[model samples]
Structure formats: structure tokens, C-alpha cells
Target chain A: MRAAIFRGAFAIQVEQIPDAALLEPTDAVVQITHACICGTDLWPYRGQGPYQPGWQIGHEWMGIVQDIGSEVRTIKRGDRVIASYDFCDGTCEFCLQGLDSACVQGGLWGFGHEGGQAEAIRACFADATLVVVPPEVEGDEALLKAILPLTDVMAAGHHAAVSANVRAGGRVAVIGDGAVGLCATLAARRLGAEQIIVLGHQPQRLALARQFGATDIITSNGDEAVQQALEMTQGGAQAVLECVGAKETIQMAVTLSRPGGTVGFVGAPHGQEVPLGHMFSSNIGLRGGLAPARAYLPELLAEVLAGRLDPSSVLDRTVSLAEVAAGYAAMDQRQAIKVMVRP
Target chain B: MRAAIFRGAFAIQVEQIPDAALLEPTDAVVQITHACICGTDLWPYRGQGPYQPGWQIGHEWMGIVQDIGSEVRTIKRGDRVIASYDFCDGTCEFCLQGLDSACVQGGLWGFGHEGGQAEAIRACFADATLVVVPPEVEGDEALLKAILPLTDVMAAGHHAAVSANVRAGGRVAVIGDGAVGLCATLAARRLGAEQIIVLGHQPQRLALARQFGATDIITSNGDEAVQQALEMTQGGAQAVLECVGAKETIQMAVTLSRPGGTVGFVGAPHGQEVPLGHMFSSNIGLRGGLAPARAYLPELLAEVLAGRLDPSSVLDRTVSLAEVAAGYAAMDQRQAIKVMVRP
Candidate 1:
């Protein structure tokens, strides 16, 4: 099986690897149909995070089930599916409470387990982690584009909006104009927010954000952005979706939120210290984290299937497994919002 | 008029000061019958916060309205009332949304405007800030005690629980043993939390916490208390109320909350920095600050009038006007949980 393997900083190679198989009773073997690079993948590629030299590197995927273990009851062999970046036992307390990201036995693909950026991949907790595509939608390009990101990005965007408690007539702001931030703009719009502000400096990304339902845009001057956000919302945003985890982004999200409003931060924060006094004094709420992707995939897929959301718009480039390294380079240089790779 | 004035650190004097009068068109002058030293009041006296010399201190009070400005409509002379620590224009959007503490024109009584620590205090936004004592309740000492804290501490505790979204059958952990913490325990109980853990090192405060319906107590031993709380509540507390504004207590509160749970912080956080990465990764929600005391006072007053809640039991001492300085000393030395001062 050919897989995209991380060799070193900014280096990825499509190399032959041993075929995947069911490692647990709840596991499923899937033949990868589509996979993509995520912003999180850039961490290891940039040498900012630990990366095992031959680790398969990708977490977002839409594929066809090739085989299933005995305990996999809901999904069957030959089923087309979208699987989340992390696998979780659905019956766990955390999973039942819609916190699949915190499931006791959950494991991250690409990092700890085999990932989908390959010809074939092994998925654990198959029944709970896989969302089968409707037969009517099989192989549809638009649906596939939407489905692939649902496994991660779209769900992450939804996580940001939901955690921030976005609602009808509320004012919402997205801090990052990455794929996740654009999706968040759409999510807030879908959730009935009357005003959506996207803060980004990149022209292309900001334009996409506007197309995705952003009512306003603030080019990344932190102070001016916060002031504009507050002024536009008549005080401050009712909910701020922080999709960029940098310290400046986090602070901007907090500062832009109205007193008693919520700041939903989905971006994985790097080296950032939060001012506790400021947060406390403003009566602001903070909620975010790794997306409970599995918990949200079904709903996101439903929306995608209905053509209500189009997460595929974020895909700036698509390539074959052999060109996987270029996808990383394009994303690293901010040349692409996202890159989809065919296995 | 006699008032308790902060002369210096650990030094207070009860001396005659100019009597307060209506300072604004919306102001009212109140002749305080009772006032108390809050946990925050001890901050400056303990030399832990910046204190200006000869600053009049107390903010919590129950009194009779002595004079009303032409703009004061809801409150009039001779009406018995309970006033919040902060005065707000109730007609503002923020106030209408139940965020009185964030009112644009609001001013904190003790910190910014004339406070009720004196015989007569000028209250701004009288119509929006004062809650009248029900005519049916007269000469009730317990109700008086309960109502006094409702002006700030009790209301703040209730805000903590409400802000954290405490639900029936949920588990709550309160990190602090001050008046606000004890009030949080009571508020959590009122909100129907099935399990309540009060973390503290003092026996008397712990006993009071238990009396206020805390089902468990964790004698502080660093992270051990958080571990015990997590173990007791299965994964972690569904809601954690941080009543101590110190860094360690804030950290402990976040540590004890389960993923997706809320950490309601009502304490005036000092110089503390929280790690955003840890909080974001855990998906714990944080909400709180300067408890919109005016918002909760009506409901809390109802509970008190109905004999369903009593907050004054936490008061360990009561001093006359001349000995008000001693009340601060007692609280500063940890000799009293709360002190009620009679004028």
C-alpha cells in the first residue's frame, strides 16, 4: 500500500507500507478514496511538534470500507464512509455526552494509529467512528468534498460555533480565516446569527470568508479589529469563534467578545498564557478544544448531503499520492487554504 | 455622618464625614441600617491590593431610602431597600439582557462611587439599582441577614452557579471557603446539583459549606483535592465555581471540571495567569465576574422571604459603627467568615 509518510521537516514521501488490517474487534479496514492535509498536520511538518519519521500523515478522509471486524455491527464492508480524525468508543460516558474528543479510549489517527493518507487504512471503533454515505450520494464530487472535511474541519468549525453558543440574532466573530474559520462563518450563518465578522489579513481567505456568509471583515490589525468588532456589534460580539490558536488571536477573540459573551476557541493553542484577571473581569466565557468530530459528523454530513453547506470550497488544490509533498509545501507557504489528495 | 475609613494598611478609623446626598439626577440617598465587610474589603486591609488613604470601604448594605432625586422613579424616600454593589441603568441593552454589571454608565459603589459603609450613601441609578424589601416582611432578623448578603456575596454565588449553567442532577465543586463560596454552595444546592464539593482547609468554613448543602469536603492538599473531587464525581465536576481569585485556586477549579463542564469564577482575580492551552485542550467552559448582583437580588430575596435560603448564617460577628475597623481586622486575620456591621 502506498502512503504519505513524514520523512523530515517539510519532507513527505509516498512510500510502500504494509497493508492495514483489523487490529480490534471494532475495527474496520477501509480503502482510501480521498484524503487531505489539515492545519494541524502543519505542526509536525514545521518541526514544531514531535513527528515519527515514517508515520502516515493525514487524518481527514472519505473512503469505502474494505473489511470489518466481527464486532462492527452498524457499518458493513463496501459501505462508503467519512471517519473523524480521532476514534472513540461510542458507548463511553464522554462519547454519550457528545465529548468524543475526550473519550477514555480515544486515539488520534496519523499521530498514534494508522491514518487515511494511504491506499488503505485501519479504523478503530468502526461502528461509532464511521458515518456511512447515503447510496444516493456515492462518488458525488460535491458531496465527497463536503464529506471529507466533515471528518475534521467542518466539524471543528461547528465545534467552535456550538461551544460559543451562537444563536439567532446574535453577533459572531471568527478569528482565523483558515478553512475552519470559513466553515465557522457558514456555521454561524446556518445557526441564524444576524451578524458574522471574519478577521483575517489574507485577501483570498478573507474573500472566501465573505462568500461563506461573513457580514463583515477586519484585516488582522489586532487593536483595530477588536475595536471594529465591538463597534459593529454595538458593544462587542455575542460569541467569538477563535479558530486560530496563536496568543494574539486568542486575545483578540476575548477582547472582541461582549461582557458575558462566550469565546469558543477551537484552534490548538501553542505557547500562550491567558490573562485570568482580564477574563474574569469581563465576565466572558471560554469553551473550545479538539472537535468532537465523531459526535458532529452525522449532523454535518446530513447538512452536506442536503446541499446546505459546501465545505469543499476550502479545497484550493487536489493531487495524487505522489504529489503529497507539494500539498504540504503549498499549505505551509499559505498558497492554499487546503489540499485534497487522492490515494 | 460616621463612616469606616481606610487610613492605611491594617488601619481603619470610624470618624465623622460629610453626609452623602444625591450626586446625580438619577441618584438616591440611603440611610444605611446595616452594612458588612466583604471578603474583597479585606483585600486592601490585608495589604494585598492597592488601597487609597481615607477611602470609604463597604459596598454591601440594606437601608431606608432617605432622599430621591427627580429622576429616581422606582425608589422613593421611606422605602426600605437593598442596593447592589454597582449601580446600573436598567434600561440599557446589557442590563435588559441580565448583565447589569456591564452597564455602560454603571459605577461600583465602594471602588468608584460613594459606598454604604457610611451612615448615608449616595446611590446612582436608584431606580435600577435598589430592590425594595417586601412589605410583608418586617422585623425578621434571619431575613435581614439573608438579604444583606444578597446585595453582593449571595448574589455573586448565585451568579457563579447560573453562569456555569448548573442543572438538576449535575455535580458542582466550589473552590473557596469565603462568604461567596459558601453562598455558591447554597446556590448550587438550590439549582439542584446532586453532588456538591466544597474545597477548603478550615473546619468552620467547611462545616458552613456542609450546612449550605455541600455533600463533600476536600481539605486542600494541592492537587489532591482536585483528584478527590474528580474521583468523587466520576470523571470531574459538571460545574466548578472558583470563589478564590488566586492563581492556584483558579487552576484547581479548571483541573476539577470535566471536559465540556463550566468553571464559573466570581472571585476578583488578582495577578494570575492561566494557561490557555490547558484550558482549551480540556474544553472546559469559563464564565463569571463581578456578579450582576442587581440581577440575582430579586430572586434571592424571594428565596429568603420564603425561608428557602439563609445566607447570613456564615456571618460570624457583628460590630457597631465605632468598631467597624475591628470587623475588618477580624476578617483580615481570618477570624471571621463574614462580619455584619450595624450603624
Candidate 2:
């Protein structure tokens, strides 16, 4: 099997690797069909995080099960499935509370376990970790790419909106306008927010955000953006989704929210500090983190299958497995919002 | 009339002042029976806040209505009442949302409007601001003093508990051992939290915290306190109430919470910065502010009248209006957790 392996900062290679097999009764081997790049993937790629040479380098995927272990009762070979970026037992106290991302036995794919960037990948806790993709749309190319991002970004965007308690007729502001932020705008729209603002400086990304239902856009001058959002919302946004993992972005999200409003942050913050003083007196709430992707994928998948939502729009470009390295580089250079790779 | 007026930093005097009278159609004149020293009062007394010389100095009180205007429908002359620290119309969008502290036309009694630290007070928006004292409990000294604190501290404590969503049989941690923190412990217990930890170093305050149903105590060392709380709860506390406005206290509260847990911060934050990196990954939420005291007084008054709760236990000493200066000095020096002043 060939896998996209991390060589070092700013480098990746698609090379022959040892084939993965079922290592436990609860495991399943998936032949990767589609995989996509994520903002989080850029962290290690940019030398901001620890990465080992030859490590499997992707976590987003949709695939077909090539083999299933004896104890895997819910899924079998040849079934199309979408797995979350993080694997969980789904029965732990955290999972039961709808915080599967924090599940005690969970393994973060790509980081903690061998990821799904290869031709074939092993998925653990198959019964609890895999979602059987609905069969009615099995051969749809766009839907297949959509599922890959859904395993992480789309679900994360939904989590951000949900955590902020976005409601019908409410004003919502999405900070970042990255893939997740655009998805959040769509999610907020789906949740019935009447007004949506996407704050970003990138022209292409902001244009995509507007297409995704943002009623307004503000370039990354955070202070001015917050002021404009406040004026537009008659005070401040009823809910704010902070999708960027920087201190300024989070602060802007907090300040843009109305008194008693909520700020849901989904970014994997690397070097950010929250201003608690501003939040305390403003009565703003901060909630969100790693998306409970598995918990949300079913509904998001249904929306995608039903054509009520289109997350595939975020897949600005696609490349073959042999060109996976270039895809990563494009994403690293901010030239692409999202890159999909056909395996 | 005689009133305690703030002259400068560390300077307060009980001296002759003009009597208060009805200033609006919705106004009521009350002869204060008991006015208590509050933690917020120390802010101006110590010159830590913006203060003007010879300003009225208190916001917590229970009194007898001496007069009312044509528009005052809720109470008449001779009615005994306990009013919140801030006056609100109770009909604005914020008030309807149960955030009376941010009411559109709200006025703070001590900071901006004429306060209740004197023998007489002119209360605006009387119908929406005052809670009538039950006849049977009007003369009860403990209940009267309790009513004074209810105008601020007790209500603030309840706000903390409510914002944090403290549940029955859940573990709760309270940061700060001020009157509000002690009241927060009591509020958590009332809301059915089975285990309560109060973080503080003062013996007298900690003893009062215990009396208010704190099951454990963590002295000022926040990091050790978080670890101890996590160990006690088998993970992390389900809810944390931050009653001190310091940055470290806010950080500790955020750290002590479990994933998906909330921290209710009622403290008027002086200067605090939140660590967004940890907050984003942990999924901890923060909610609260200057408590909407006007929203909770009715229920709080009912509880006090029924002998189900007592807030006066926080009062460590009492002084005459003439000796209020000493009371402030005592609280500032940690000689007393709280003090009550009789006019």
C-alpha cells in the first residue's frame, strides 16, 4: 500500500508502506476512497507541532471496508463508511453526555493512531467509530468528498453553531472564514440564524463565505469588525462562532457578542489567550472545542444526502493520490480552502 | 437626613445631607431600616475605582416605604421592601431575558444614582425594582439583614449558580471566599449540588463558607486546588463559580471544570486574562457578570421568608452609620468578612 507520510516540516511524500490489517477483534480495514486536508493538518506541516518521519498524515476520510474483525457486529466487508477524526468507544460517560471528542478511550487519528491517508487503513473500535454511509448515494463523487470533510470540519462547524446556541431569527457572527468558518456560516443558516457575518481578510474565502449565507463580511481588522457587527446586530451578535485559533480572533469573537450572548470556539488553539475580564462583565459565554464529529455526522450526512446542505463547496480543488504532496503544499500556502485527494 | 458619604480614598463620614424625595412618577421614598456594608463598597472606599467626593456610599438595604408617586402600583406608603442594588424597568428586552443588570434604562444605586447608605433613599422605577417583604418576616432582624445582602451578594451568588447550571448531585467548586462566594456555596447546595469546594485562605471566611455548605476547602493555591478538585470528583468539577474578580481566580475556575462543564463568574473582574488555548481544547464554558439582582429578589425573598435560606450568616460584625468608616477599614484589612451598618 502507498501512504502519504510526513517527512519533516514543509515536506510530505507518497511512498510504498506496509499494508495495515485487523490488529484487534474490534478493528476493520478500510480501503480509502477519499481523503481531505484540514486546517489542523497544517499545524505539524508548518513546524508548529511535533511530527515524526514516516508518520501517517491525514485523518479525514470516506472508505469501503475491505475486511472486518470477528467481533465487529454492526459493520461488514464492502460497506461504505465515514469515520470520525477521533475514535471513541461511544459508551463512556463523556460519550454518553454527547462529548465523544473527550471520550476516555478515544484515539485521535493521524496523531495517536495510524491515520486514513493511505490506500488501506485500519480503524479501531469499528462498531462504535464507523458510520455506515447511506447507500442511496454511494457513487456520488461530490458527496464522497463531502463525507471526508464531514468527518471533521463540517461536524466541527455544526458543533460551533450548536454550542453558541444559534437560533432562528438570531444574529450570528463567524470569525475566521476558513473552511470551518464557512461551514459554520452554513450551519448557522441551517439552524435558522437570520443574519450571518463572516470576518476574514482573504478575498476568495470571504466570497465563499458570502455564498454560504453570510449576510455581511468584514476583513480581519478585528476591532472594526466587532464594531460593524455590533451596529449591524443593533448591539452585538446574538451568537459568535470563533473558528480561528488565535488570541485576537477569540477576543474579537467575545467582544462582538451581545451581553448574555455566547461565543463557540472550535479551533485547535495553538497560541491563544482569552480575555476573561472582558467576558466576565459582558456576560458572554465561551463553549466548544474538538468537535464530537461522530455524534454529529449522522445528521450532517443526512443533510448532505438530502441535498439540503452542500459542504462540498469548500472542496475548492481535488488531486489524485500521487499528487497528494502538492495538494498539501497548496493548502499550506493558503492558495486553497480545502484540497481533496482521490485514493 | 444623615448619610455616609465618600469623601476620598479611605475617607468616609456620617454627616448631615439633604433628604431624598420622589424624583419621578415611578419613584418611592424609603426610610432605610438597615443598610449593610458590601464588598463592592470597598472598591470606592479604597479608591480602586472611579469615585467622586461626597457621593452616597452604599447599595444594599431594606427599608420602610415613606412615600410613593402616582405611577407606583406595586407598593404604597408604609410598605416594607427590599430593593436590588440596581433599578430596572423590568420590562426591557434584557430584563425580559432575565438580565436586569443590563436593562436598557437601569441605574446603579450607589455608583451612578442616589444610594441607600443614608437614613432615606429615593428609589426610581419602584414598581419594578422593589420586592415586598412578607408581613410575618418584616420585623425579623436576621431576615432583614439577609434582605440587605440579597440586594447584591446573595442575588449575585444565585446568579453564579444559575449561570453555571449547577445540577443536583453534581460536584461544584467555588473560587473566592468573599461574601458572594460563601453565598454561591449556599446557592449551589440549594440547587442540590452534593459536593461543594470553597477555595480561600482566610479562616473566618472559610468557616463561613463551611457553614454555607462547602464540603471542602482549597486555600489560595489555585493549581493545587484544581488538582485536588479533579481528584475529588474523579475527573473535574461539573460546575465552578468564580466570585473573585482576579485573573488567577478566573483561570483556576476554567481549569477546574470538566469538559462540557461551565464556570459562572459573578465577580466584577478587575483585570483578568483567560487562556484560550486551554479553554478551547477543554470545552469549558464561562458565563456570568454583575448579577441581575432585580430578577432574583422575589424568589430569594420568598426563601428568606420561609426560613429556607439565611444570607445574614455572612455578616461578621455590625456598626452604626457613624462608624461605617471603621467597618470599611475592617473589611479592607480582612478583620471582617462583612459588616452591617444601622442608620
Specify the highest-DockQ model's number: 1
lDDT per residue (tens digit) for residues A1-343 in model 2: 9988888888878889889899999999999988887878887888877777768889898789999999999998989999988899988988898788888999788874787777989998999999999776677787776667789989989999999999999999999888999999999999999999888889998888888999999884867777888888899998999898777788788888888899998977655466666676667888888888988988898888888888888999998889988988899888899998888
* Residues B109-169 of candidate 2: C-alpha lDDT, one tens digit per residue: 8775787778999988999998888777665776677767898899999999999999999
The TM-scores, one per candidate, come to 0.97, 0.97
TM-score of chain A, all candidates: 0.97, 0.97
Candidate 1 clash pair list: none
lDDT (10s digit) by residue, model 1, range B266-305: 9887654665666776688888988888988888888888
DockQ of each: 0.69, 0.65
lDDT of 1: 0.87
User: What stretches of model 1 exceed 4 Å from their correct place?
Assistant: B23-25, B48-50
Weakest lDDT window of 10 consecutive positions for candidate 2 chain A = A269-278
